[model samples]
Target: MNKDSAQTALLWIVAAGFFMQSLDTTIVNTALPSIANSLHVAPLAMQPIIIAYTLTMAMLTPASGWLADRFGTRRVYFVAILIFVLGSICCASAHTLGQLVIARVLQGVGGSMLLPIGRLAVLRSVSGEQYVSALAFISVAGQLGPIAGPTLGGWFVQDMTWHWIFLINVPIGAVGLYAVRRFLPTHGETQAPPFDFVGCGLLSLCMIAFSLSIEAPFSTHRAAWAAGLFVLAVVSALAYIPYARRRRNPLFKLALFSEPNFSVGLIGNLVCRIGSSAVPFLVPLLLQLQLGYSPLHSGLMMLPAALAGTVAKRWIAPLIRRYGYDTFLLVNTLIVGSSIVAFALITRGTPLAIEIAILAVFGAANSMQFAAMNSVTLKDLSHEDAGSGNSLFSMVQMLAIGLGVSIGGGLVNLFSAQWGSAALGFRFSFACVGVITLVSAWIFRQLDVAPAQPKVRAPATHSAGR
Candidate 1:
C-alpha cells in the first residue's frame, strides 16, 4: 500500500484497539446481573470481576510505554490484541465468579497496553503536523465505546446471552491482529532505560492493598484483614518516597507534586472519581434488579447520560475560560456530587422523564469535571516532567475506578444486610458516594484563584486516560 494508505490503515488499527479496550470497560456492567444468575452468585458480588480488570490495568499501565519502547510497538500491539481475544474466550467459558475474575485480569493485562502502545505507534508513524487530527480521529472511538458499550452489552444479554458480550470481541480482535501486522509500522525496539522494578512493585502493592481493604468486608476476618491491608497500603506508599529519591530513573519523581495545581488536581481526581466512577456500575444493576427493567432497557437508559456528556464537552472550554479552573471545578464538582445524590431519589414510582433528566445532568457535569481535572493536573508540569506526570495521573485514574467499584459494591452489601431491603441499600449507597464526591470540592478549592487565560487544551493523553 502507498504511504498515505498505510497511515490511514494504521489509524484504523489503533482506533479499533481503543474501541475494544474502552468497550470492555463498560460492556460487562450491563451484563453483570445476567452473569451473576448464570454463575449462581448475587449480582452485587460481581464487583471483583470489574475491580480485578481495572486494578490490573492500573498496576500495569505505567509499564506500557517502557514495554513498547523495549519491544517493537508492532510486535507488542499485536500481542496485546491476541491476549485480549484469548481472555475474552476465557471469560465466555467461565463457570464461576472466580473464573470470570481471573479471565478479566488476563484481559486487563492486554487492555493496559492497547491505548498507550497504539498511541506510541501513531506518534512514530504519523507526521507531527497531523498528530492532533490523528488523535481527534482516534478519540471518536473512545467516546463511542462508552456510548455503545452499555447498550450493546444490554442487547446481547437480553436478546442472546451474556457470553456474547465477551465473544463479540473475538471477531473484532481477529481483524485487529491482521491489521496490526499489515499496517502498523515496525519501528524496531529502541534502547530503553532500565525500568524501576522496585518502585513499580511498591506502587502496585499499595494499590492492591488499598483496593483489598475496601473489599475486606466480604472476607471471613473482615476487621482484621481490613486493618492489616490498610496498614500495608500506607507502608508501601511511604516506602516509595525514599525509593524514588534514591533511584536514578524512578517510576515517578516527587517533584511532579511540587506544582500546586498538579497536587490538588491529582487528589481531586482520585477522590471525586471514587464517587463518580461507581455510577456506571451501580446504575445498571439498580435498573435491572430493583426497578425490574430488562437488561436492554437498563443499557438504553444510559444513553441520556452518555449523549449528554458528549454534548457537554463543547461547553467546557467556554465555561472554564470564564470561571477559570478553580471556580469551574469547584462549582462543577458540587453539581456533579449533588447529581449523584439525586440518584437516591430514583424509585419504582419516579417518572421516567425525571430519571432521564437526572442522568443527563450528571453526565454533562461529570464529563466537564473529568476534562477540567485532567487539564489542571498536568497543565503546570514542566516538559521533562509531563511524561511521568501523565503516566502517574493515568495510573491514579484507573486505580480510582477500581476503588469506586469496591467501595460502591461494599456499601450496597453493607447497607442491604443492615437494612434488610435491597432498595434501601441502593438508596443509601448512592447517598454515601455522593458525599464522597462532595468532599473533593474542597480539594479543588485549593487551586490558586486567578483570572482565566487563553484556553490551554490538555494533551491527547486525556483521551486515552478516559
Candidate 2:
C-alpha cells in the first residue's frame, strides 16, 4: 500500500511538469499587451514572441526521446527543469522584446523536453493497469493549464506586472526540479543511437524558414525579404526530404509516413490547427485591443471556459466511443470551427454575458476535439511505433501552433491593411481561420465508418531511483 501511495505521488509530480508546460503556452497571451507596452513594441508585432518559443520547441522535439534514451531520462528531465527555471527567470528580468524572445527560446528548449520525458517516465514506471489513470490525470492537468492560463495571466497582469507571469514558474520549477531529481528513474541498459545532427539541422532550418516566411509577408513591409524567406523555406524542405531518405536513421524516420492513418492524421492535424490554434493568441488580443476590456476582466472572462472544459472532459470519451474516431473528428471539428466564426462576428456592442457564453462554448468543444483527435492519431500504431509516432505528433502540434500565430497574425495584418481598420481585419482573419478549419473536416472523411478507437496500452514493469 505504501509503495502504491508513493507511486501515485511520483506520478502527480510528473503531472505538475505537464501542467507547467501548458500553462506557459497560455499564460503569456493575456499578458502580451502589457509585455509589449513595457518592451516598447507594437502589440501586433509581438506574435514573434509567442511564435519563437513554440517554433523552437517544434524544432527540438523530434530529438527529445532520443536524448532521453541516450542520456538517462532522469538526467535529461533534471536538465530540462533547470533550463526551464533559469529561462523563466531570464524572461521575468528581460528589459526588451528581443531579450524576452531569446529567453522564451531558452524556456522552449526545456518546455519541449518536459512533457515528452515525463510521459515516458509515466509509461515506464506505472503498471499497465494504472496507465490509463496516469494518462487521465496528466491530461486533466495539462488541459487545465490552457483553460486557466488566460484567466491567471489577466489576474496577474492586472494585479501586478506582466513579468510576474514568467516569474511564477520559478518557484514551481524549483519544486519540480527537486521532485524529478529525487523521484525520476534511470534507463541504464538501453542502446543509444548517435545524435542525428545533420538531419536535425536541416529540419530546424526548414521549420524556421517556413514559419518566418509566413510571418515576414505580414509583419514587415518588405516584399523582397518575404519572398527571399519563402524561397528559403521551399529549398530547405526539399533538402530534408532527400536527406531523410538517404540516411540510415533519419530525424523523422520518414518510413513512418507509409502508414495511412498516421500520415493523414498528421497532415490533418497540421492543417486543422492552422485555423484553431491561434484562437488563444487572438482571444486576448481581441479583448484588449478591440473590445476595450481590461487585462484583468479579459482574464476573468476565460474562467468560465476553463471551468466548462473540466465538465466537458467527461463527455469526450463517450462521444468518441459511440460515434467512432472519424465521426467524432468530423463533427467536433465543425463545432470548434463554427465557434471561431462566432467569436469573429462578436462586436463591441455584443453583451458581456453573451461573449462569455460564446468563449465558454468554444472552449468546451475545443477541449473535446483535442482529446479525440490525439487518441485517434495514435490508435493504430504498433507498440514499436507508439513512441516515435507520439513524438512526431507532438512536434507537428507545436509546429502548427507556431504557424497558426504567424499565419493568423499575418492574415489579420493583411486584412487590416486592405480594410483600413484593425478591428475589421481581425474579423476577416477570424473568418478566414474558420473557413480553413471547415475545410479540414474533409480529412476526417478518409476514415472508415467504424474508425478504430485507440485503446490505452498497458505499460510494462516499471521506478523512482532516488
Candidate 3:
C-alpha cells in the first residue's frame, strides 16, 4: 500500500509488542501467589520472578540502539518477536521457581529490545509531524495493557492455571511477529562500530550485584554479603563512569546527562519509581501471605486500582498544565507514598471495599506521576538525544524496579524478623516505603514551574519499568 499506510501499520505492530511486554510485567503480579503455591516456594520469595524480568531489561536496554543500528530494525524486530515468543513457551513450561526465573530472563532478553528499537524505527521513518502522535498512540495502548493485565491475569489463573497467563502471550506474540515482518520499514544503513564488550560486562555485573544485594536479606540474611555487594556495585559503577567518559563511542553517551532537565528527571524517575513499583510486587504477597487471601480474591482486589489508573490518565495532562511538573510530581509523590502505607496497614479484618478504594486512589496517583515525570524527562530532549537519553532512562527505570522489589522484599523480611508477625512486618515496611516516597517530593522541588502546553499526544514508548 502507500508509505504512509505502511508507517501507520508499523506503529500498530510496535504497539502490539509494547502491549505484550507491559501485560507480562504486570499480569504476573496477581498470578504470583498461584505460581509460588504450585512451585512450593514462599510467596514472599517470589520477588525474583519480578526482579529477573526487570534486571534483565535494565542490563540489556542500553545495547538495543547499537544492535538496531548494526542489524537493521526489521531484522532485529523479527528476532525480538521470536525471542519473546520462545520465552513465553519457556515460561509456560516452567515447573520450578528456578525454571520460572530462568524463563523470565529469556523473556526479558526479548522484551528489553522491543520498545526502544521499535521507537527508534518510528523515529527514523516517521516525519516529525507524525512522530509524537504515533508514539502517543502506541504509548496509550501500552498503558492500557497494564490497566487490564492484573484483572485478566487473575481471571485466567483462577479459571485455569498460572501457566495460562504466560501461554496467552503466544497468540499475541504471533500477531506481533507477523505484523513486524510484514509492515515494518527496512533500515538501509549499517552501523560500523564494534560492540564494547568490557563496558557491557562491567555494567551487567553492576546491575546484577545490586539487584541481588537487595534480595540478599531474604535469601541468606547475611549483612556481610550484602555489604560486599554494595562495595562491588560501587566499584563496577565507578569504573563505568570514567570508562564511558574516555571512550570515543561508549555504550551510552555521557553527553546525554549534560542536559540538566533530562539528567534530573532521570534521577527523579528512578527515585519516584522505586516507591511506586514496589507496591505491585508487595501488595500481592501481602494479600496472600499476611492476610491469607486467595489468589483469585487478591487479584479481584487489585482490579479497582488498575481501573482507577486508566481513568486518571485523561485527567493527568490537565493537572500538569494547571500546576506544572514540579508541583505535580511533588504532590503526586506524596499521594502514591501514602497509598503504599495504606496497603501496609491491610490485614484479614481490613474491609475489602475500603482496601480496594485505597488501591484505586494509589493507581490514579501513580499513573499521573508517570505521565508527568515521563513528559518532563523527555520534554527537553530533542530528536538527536532521543535514542541515548530514552535508552538511559529506560535502563534506570528497570534498574530501579529491580531494586524496589528486591529492597521492598528485604524490608518485609526484616520487619517479619523484628515484629514476629507477618502482618506487622508488612505494615512497617509500607510505612517506611511511604516515608521514602514522601522524601522524593524533595527531588521534584528542584524543578522550575514552567506551564505545560497541552497538545495532542502520540507514540512515546511506555515502559512498565519503574
Encode model 2's per-residue lDDT on 230-277: one tens digit a residue: 888788878888988888877767777777777887788788888878
lDDT of 3: 0.80
TM-score of each: 0.98, 0.92, 0.92
Model 1 stretches astray by more than 4 angstroms:
218-221, 454-465
Q: lDDT per model, in order?
A: 0.89, 0.79, 0.80
Cα deviation in Å at residue 462, candidate 3?
5.6
Model 2, 44: alpha-carbon shift in Å? Answer: 1.2
Clashes of each: 0, 0, 9
lDDT of 3 at 37: 86
Task: Give per-residue lDDT, candidate 2, residue 355.
Answer: 91
For residues 1-466, what per-residue lDDT tens digits would candidate 1 score against the true structure? 9999999999999999989988998899999999999999999989989889988888888898899899889999999999999999999999999999999999999998898898889999899999989988888898898899999999999899999999999999999998888778898999999998999999999999998987897544379889999999999999999888999899999998888888888888999999999999899999998999999999999999989988888888888888788888889999999999999999999999999999999999998888788888887789999889988988888889988898888888888888999899999999999999999999989987575662444433324435
**Lowest summed lDDT over 10 consecutive residues: which window, candidate 2?**
457-466
Superposed model 2: Cα runs more than 4 Å off = 448-466
Best model number under TM-score: 1
Q: By how many angstroms RMSD does model 2 differ from the true structure?
A: 3.8
Candidate 3 residues lying further than 4 Å off, grouped into runs, are: 448-466
